[model samples]
Target chain A: MSNATKSVPDAEGRFGEFGRRFVPETLMEALDQLHEEYLRSKADPDFQSQLDHLLKTYVGRPSPLYFAERLTEHAGGAKIYFKREDLNHTGAHKINNTIGQALLTLRMGKKRVIAETGAGQHGVASATACARFGLDCVVYMGEEDIRRQKLNVFLMRNMGAEVRSVTSGSRTLRDAINEAMRDWMASVDTTHYILGSAVGPHPFPMIVRDFQSVIGSEARQQCLDETGQLPNEVIACVGGGSNAAGMFYPFVEDYDVSLTGVEAGGRGTQPGDHASPLTYGSKGVLHGSFSYVMQDEDGQTQDVHSISAGLDYPGVGPEHSYWKESGRVQYTVATDDEALEMFQLVAKLEGILPAVESSHAVAHAVKAAQKRSPDEIVVVCLSGRGDKDISEVARLTGIEM
Target chain B: MDSRISAVFASLKEQNQMAFMPFITAGDPDLAATQQVIRTLGASNVDMIEIGFPYSDPIADGPVIQASYTRALESKVSVSQIFKALGELDHEELPPLVAMVSFAIVFRTGVDQFLSSCVESGISGLIIPDLPGDEAAEVFEKVKGAGLDLIQLVAPTSPRERVRKILKSCSGFVYCIAVAGTTGERERVADSLLDQLKWLREETDLPLAVGFGISKPDHVEPLRGLADGVIIGSAIVRRFQELADKTLSSEDLQKELTKLAGDMVTATHTK
Candidate 1:
């Protein structure tokens, strides 16, 4: 925050030395065109009004910044607040981006959309926007994710989006992104690729972050209105880091707010045992963007693991890489056990079933909150709801749900 | 640019012929098979060979080549091993070599190591499809400084301004993506190929090599006068897949591959 880091990516989309387009020549012109269209759309008051209206009425925006009384008391130190993105329609912050991209898709006169998803929140959100706009949609999902995220898959299909199962390496989010990119390469003329997170080639990271920044912008104002000051700590889970980038962006100038991102540590610190790219990975390219990636010595992407499907990606957003390099944000990790425990604890104590991805932040917030005095305020972004994860969690816990 | 690459193109031009290059993923089926593939194509009158350094995510390639990369990775092939294996080859017997690699690998393996490896491996030129041509000046300059040609790709969808920028960064030859899509075997070349060729011929002095969907021997005849080289990717590699499947014997694979290469070579060489 407060000029601690480089400004936003340059005209060519380089975030310092990270986040340049590393895609095939076939997609470069289309990327330039998309970046131009997005800039115009961002400035158009009519487009802004339409998007704002949808967020406010259709998605129930200004999602509450509620003080989690029980979670705060249990931490026994700092007061904790929850940025309730879990309450947004489609039950995640993903819709904020999908709706925004969908508007751009229409503006560009594209009638078809392609997307890839991990935890299914992005898929469900993409499907919702497509169905609402009467646009053709296809969402690529990894076969492994399909088995675990059946509810979201069904939701997408029922909403008229075709969910293609990718059986490539790892059969997870990374493979899905690869497959979606291939589709984009072939269908770019009439299709707009709705990348689910603040990753991928140029303009996508900027676009997704701009749309999702509503989360932090609102949380900042609401926190001030209710508590009369900015929180000392802003914590969020990072998986492609869409929500975290959005939340961190608005507070980047608020020098007093300490930003922390919780990455999925899965089971352990070994290479394939976790998905914490920022903590354990080096700089490389994945899914069209230069970012921190879980790659071997020869730059082959490695298989990564996490209990939360959304947080199982092998690459982080380019902005996160820049932030890491600039010392603007402190990134930490939450192992599967810690996150699973918080999933249950938050459900019982706070009457909120946090998506396992957000449960990672909940797990870390416990430690961070305990470290601070009662006078300090710490806020966690509850990035999504856990409805899609109930069956997976039941199976993991050996319960028949 | 390497002196050998220029000599190869100049020789082809003197013969009133176009160069023929066949591509295969380096570690597919195994490095031994890849080495054999290079030798086979080399002996078949092919002008140059394009070896793919397998990447985990090869979005620029179609399903056939993508499968080859997957198979190569399953064997746990490393870039060092590939370089070592190729280094052991008799460059005297082979044609000029180029590698179609992802920029991610080049970035991971620093510029000095990568170019040194290329020199050690007898690779004459480089075709990195995923390196954004518009943002490639820095690496392009580094590669040019190392005396290795980093070929730039110009696609059918490229805006003219972007095309001009990309052309300035090219060396040795320009890889003209014959189609507006990824590398694959297609039924026909686009109807606008002649116009694109004419436009590119007027814009830069770099030799034009048409790739991406130039699959068969027949594809060569059509691009004869228009392009300086013709690259056959998935079609040639598809036979290697059959070799790996064991449905085709080594002897038969050689005969089939040799015949395919012979046909394209003949067509490319004939005015």
Candidate 2:
């Protein structure tokens, strides 16, 4: 990777016509302000030193790049490596972006931080940051998500964050985002929205992606240090594509390295049954930016289903859309049963409980690994731990938790 | 540059009266009830009417409008359905109709085709809150070429430079977001509204119309001299929300909505 990646986004925040500020006029100034501040923060020595300190001490950076020997032997064709982001504080890569945004909130002199969460990982991470900084935190989670991710909800509450239940639409991640956007519009003066994903309007996708790029940067160095070469392929689950974007950006220009993003396949290939927008959606807008979205011919968003709440969104990040369009990254899907199988297998075989979201990547990696030569290597980003999902997993497998 | 919208605002300017445009989701109750709502507001001395195309994710709208869109979409209302439902009613019976739709919908359907559809449906102006920056300059031309006006939203938070850019692209009028928030009812219009009105007035000849949180007759009075028009959304849509009770007939809905609109419409005549 080069020292700079040409800032993927142009002045209008568009990654080739994919991402732009498609929010209300009221939020335009804030978006512009955020973009400017983010750029400045990226270059400031003090900002970088402070953020780096937090990453190492608070969030516990340089998560292990472990060789999954049993899984590699099971595949029987290629060696597999897991970038253990699951070990991060709060048990997910969500903390990486939230901590960055929370710091920005203080820089902007905002006293409050608001966020929308799907499976509660982002909510917990945002709550943790606010607690650490003594800032007010409010998290919006879908009513249905709260029921599924009760433990994460508790964790967020424990950190002094107000959890607001969103009951509109499908009562999931998508609805929570809508509620959060409305909240930001009403409270833009004193509140900063710590959007959970690398999606949404303008600067958000770029900002989140920048914060998350640490994943790939660390992974790239670890693979080089351990194996003396870059991994053959880098893979990550695509919820709003933050982890994937973070893990993929550093390797985009490394032509020899392959990048794959795994999306949720839910129950079936049908639009409503699956959240695989890149696989079977038209170019439209959801949340804020223009991206691939599961929608009807009349342009209304379709309800999407996913076993992993994190990937249940109707749209992918604009950067993913651009990458797919440019043929830089190949995107695939993993069904509920496939992810669950990998989730259970990883727990027993490697003593690691990969989040169902991350298992999507593992599912694809296992398949691809079996087809490659044993000398070749594949690195999968285990984005988060599965503790928050244990109860839902039990219910799905016909066990009483 | 546009025909119907410009004419409506010009005639109001001559009379020194502010235009009253009441917004309602096109299929709030159903197409039949929506027709009655449009006809009722049209006959109640409104200068123009704004019809919202119900979207599944209306992020810029408040709960009242969001629920209204949900009701409309759940009833299986389609864009063509709304256009076909209102196809028989010509502009003369409806006044000039303006469309408030997401740019995502337009981009998905192809910008030229969406504009042509609006032209066919007799929609004279458009209010899209989420139109992208680059697409705006391009679509603004297509909208004018299709013989319709583009009404861009300008918030109080919009800086002077952004306001200038928005003013350059806009045609029919300015949709002033009275406060820095999504569309909803408010206890009072923000005091800073007068200054924004003055700032925009000094920038362009386009009419300045305030929306978002302006619900009652009192809401209109505050903007009497400063605003060229007043847009009532959530306050009006909340009444349509009552249609969910199923006991109210379309005529009764029209009567109730008309009485409410009549008072607010009268309030627009600030003289």
Candidate 3:
């Protein structure tokens, strides 16, 4: 990436028409303080060296970009490869961003870290980071999510983080975000909000994408080393579009590579159907920034449905909205039924049980593979392991054990 | 006017009709429609307009209001938009625009900036659902400095000490969150809570507005003799949604709101 393109989001932290500081007024001074602190710490060689050391040593780095040869043959089309983010410590790419932000939080002299979680992956990652850095961590989860993802609740608690169940709204991800924001507002003087996804108002998306860019950065080199060329297409499923944004960022300027984002197709495109914002939603603002959203005629947000708790959301990352508008990346959808099929297919063939959210990408890859040349290579971001989603998938699909 | 908010409340009280406080999420449905709803409510008999600054999680709200908030967030309503919408009401004879929002939004917007913006936008009062009285001192000072009223809430579960604290900081009117939980309509207001309201009436001279569980005309009428204002949230929001079909025009919505306001006013004034 050229300096011009790489610095697209400048010191002010803008990503084209996407990133900007759209935080609450109470958080302005603190956010400004954090921004200034982050800039200084990012520029400090010592800070970079320490962060790199942690990313390499504490949370395993250079996660393999393994070509699923057997699975590719079984699919009977383009060769498929997996950018194994599940191999990362804490079992997902969430750790990558959390470790970076947590280190930045400590460097900024913050005493505590607060995070909002949906499936609790980010909460666990943030808790893990806080444990390593010796910072007090608080995680806000929706009451409903806490009940559904009990294992994650236990995992976060075991990591020595205070887990507060938010009983607001549907007691889901959005509610958790609200509670986290409220907590941050009250404790901004000493707390850092380790946002889970590439959403929020401004600096968050830019900061998280930068931290998660390592996924694509590593994949590019690894893919080149093994295949002697970049994969023809890359696919990732988007919740807040974090993992997809991470894997797609380094390749944004790589014109030869095609990037596709698969959104949750929950039931169908009916009013109460899925969380496929890109395919079905229109441009609107959410979480302090303008993005695509599913709303009613009165402009009220509608309830979104998705088989995967992780992807069941009403909005996408602001950057994804920009990418969709600019035509830089294509956005598609995969129904819960289709994703389940891919989930089982991958488990049986590759012997890897992929997260239901990741299965959306796999489903998209399967569809694309059927149409593409047999020799073409496609890199699918295997975002996380399916262990956390086993019960949910089993319940939803009526498949036991 | 010593306090613009107090002046407005005093005017409503003099009319012998309990204040008709209509709560609408700014940008619900859409920003344009929200502006229209405000104008519609303003032109109607509404004594005060509580414009909800939509938050992602409204723990204090029921399904109808929660759904409205979801729409507002999806529509990308922001604190800035609330100020802008209020500014647009400059030419019209607007009912005082009092912000009904979560503490997070207030904090995110910045305490002083939010107050200053509210003042500049001609907002008469502030209602932060999550700002318990104990944590409201700093915000109260700011709101006072901006010459706007900080409306404090007294929930059913609030202890006497908390109520005293809330009464001390509150101006304009004391918002009684009729129930222990968040905002929504209920089938009935408990007799014990009514007795509590009677007790509260003896404690403070500030006009009291009973909210949360109020839905029907009977709900408004019963509280009329005891409270200074009857704050209706979820029911009105539900009515707005019911009238929000694409086929219905803004004029139609205004007519619907006018009828709803008329019924509420009738309930409060009759007997």
Candidate 4:
């Protein structure tokens, strides 16, 4: 299927068997109204142009596809490339999707934007986007995450977004999502749920992937121009699998490009020790879609452990599920220990301290490069920088500096 | 004897019938009154009881439940107190009691220790709202060993593949979150989601129990034929809140609960 056509939602706003408005009855009217507004805006060229302008001028669109020469030489094999999403204005690839959704929320005549954040990356991005659009923004974060990711909380507040610390459940991403959803349900009249990842219910995944496709679209052309051919393989870490979905979309049709998703393996498969849903999870429903999830036999969501806060989730994007079932892409796990070692290795070798979330991809790339030939090329999406992870990494590795 | 949860399902299949279930947050207004409410519900021929373990911040719960939680916490109801009170229930007299709690409470208590205590305290099942299926394996194994059911919630937002996976791991009954939002009272459950419930029923032999926003009697009426049971929470709690007065005698509270339960049971049978 054509990338654009594959990415767009169907008439009912679903992707394959995924994506439906399964909200409460009180909010059903609001969701229908939202669906109507989204449809109207989708056809409006002016709306699309405004969103595109923000993405390019405000969020720094067309992020670089830099060749990681030093790391490639150190690995002593395949040439490695990095999609510089860290160069985005908000310091992560999340801004691209946030800017698009925030614009849509405004066009729909919504006055407030509500979002759930884990590790605060998505919250910060949403806050930044809302601020730029002059929209009222409220972000829900797990109380524990608020304590750990204080910097992000500060940044979000500085951007003038109201930060609500969710103390229920594990006090993590899932709890934050639950709280944000409750707020949206109550205030659906004037609010938009700016889902962070390529998850939630149906239209969210489809919409997020569409906004982030710029990553893959840009990287694909850059690769072709650099090597006169597609890269041999592409690697990205999968949390809710947004960045990976974005980077993999343009390349899915390329039969020659091998796509690999690196899931956080935490310490190991010991109970309560990892977030590698695809590697360890069975097919289950979560966040409004059916896909692989880390759950117990009774189908209760399990507490997912990961070194990277962003990748600490039990479910992934639905499109990833489709791609996974179709055998179009491969999935693997990278342990916290392995990811940590790679995080340090890349920092020392390439001077790039990637976000712990992106280090999983770096870990896999290091292993894959060792097996591939020098002529082979492996492009890893360096989704975000590691400045946010310095304290956690130090505590994890016992490195004071 | 009124059918135990297991026997209720067995008889339902034999008679080509379904069971009625109603959920209420324990200690919503006051401890004594809430206990009476539970006893009343048990006597009403309800299939099973879902007793919410009130947390300070119940993220998955809406405003009604949040208010109930505030009242419960104000009453100083600790997890220990909940177990102690449940331990007082005559096992033969009370219906099967399942604890619906958030993960924070369980994690703080320690998963293994909590399951062991639950088994000892006469709790037959647990529905931890925040625990994802994959991460629940170890806890599931422990709960299974202790002969307790670890119930799973399947939300409207859940994908089909997820439903199958959750069904495979689930025990007791499968909880279908009829709506996307948290627990609260609603006028009606959407007809479209009923089809999703039907889809889950075909995927597993386990009895399907629908919850979330099931406040009124009419909400459970339609599910009588399609689902194995129905669960209600916020509406019952609201009833207790309305009745709570410093001077109300225990007998008076029990009478109120009995009246509410009788009305609910009558609605279920008639609808």
Residue pairs of candidate 1 with colliding backbone atoms: none
Q: Per-candidate TM vs. native? A: 0.98, 0.98, 0.67, 0.69
Better of 2 and 4 by DockQ: 2
Between candidates 1 and 2, the DockQ winner: 1
Sorted on DockQ, highest at the top, how do the candidates line up?
1, 2, 4, 3
Write the number of the candidate with greater TM-score, choosing between 1 and 4: 1
Candidate 1 residue spans exceeding 4 A from truth: none
- What is the Cα root-mean-square deviation between model 4 and the actual structure? 10.0
Off by over 4 Å in 4: A1-23, B1-22, B25-39, B42-60, B63-232, B235-256, B259-271
Q: What does candidate 3's lDDT look like per residue over B1-271, in tens digits? A: 5676677667767777677787887887877887778777777657778888776655456667877776666566767776877787753477777888766566545678778888777788898765656557778888888888898877665556557866777888988867654566789987867887898998899988888888778887567678888888887788656655566566776787788887887776554
Q: What share of the true interface contacts does each candidate keep?
A: 0.72, 0.72, 0.07, 0.08
lDDT of 2 by residue, A34-134 (tens): 88888889999999989989999999997999999999988887789999999999999999998899899999999999999988889999999999999
The superposed Cα distance between candidate 3 and the true structure at residue B23, in angstroms, equals: 8.6
Residue-by-residue lDDT tens digits, candidate 1, A304-362: 99999889889999999888887889999999999999999999999999999999999
Ten consecutive residues with minimal summed lDDT in candidate 4 chain A?
A: A19-28
DockQ (Cα-based) per candidate? 0.78, 0.74, 0.07, 0.09
- Which candidate wins on TM-score? 1
Fraction of native contacts in model 2? 0.72
Q: What is the C-alpha lDDT profile of model 4 across A1-401, one tens digit per residue?
A: 32322544566555555444333333444555666776677788997888787778888887888899999988889999999998898789999889888888877888899999999999999999888889999999989999999999999999999999887656789878778878876677688999989876556787788788889999999999988888999999999999999999888888678999999999988658999888888665565555677765434567789999999998888788777767778999999988888889888988888888999999999888989999999999999988999999888778788
As for TM-score, the candidate ahead, 1 or 2, is 1
lDDT of 3 by residue, A121-202 (tens): 9999999999988899999998888888899989889989999997756678877886677677556767899999998765
List where candidate 3 sits over 4 angstroms from the true fold: A1-6, A10-14, A399-401, B1-50, B53-271
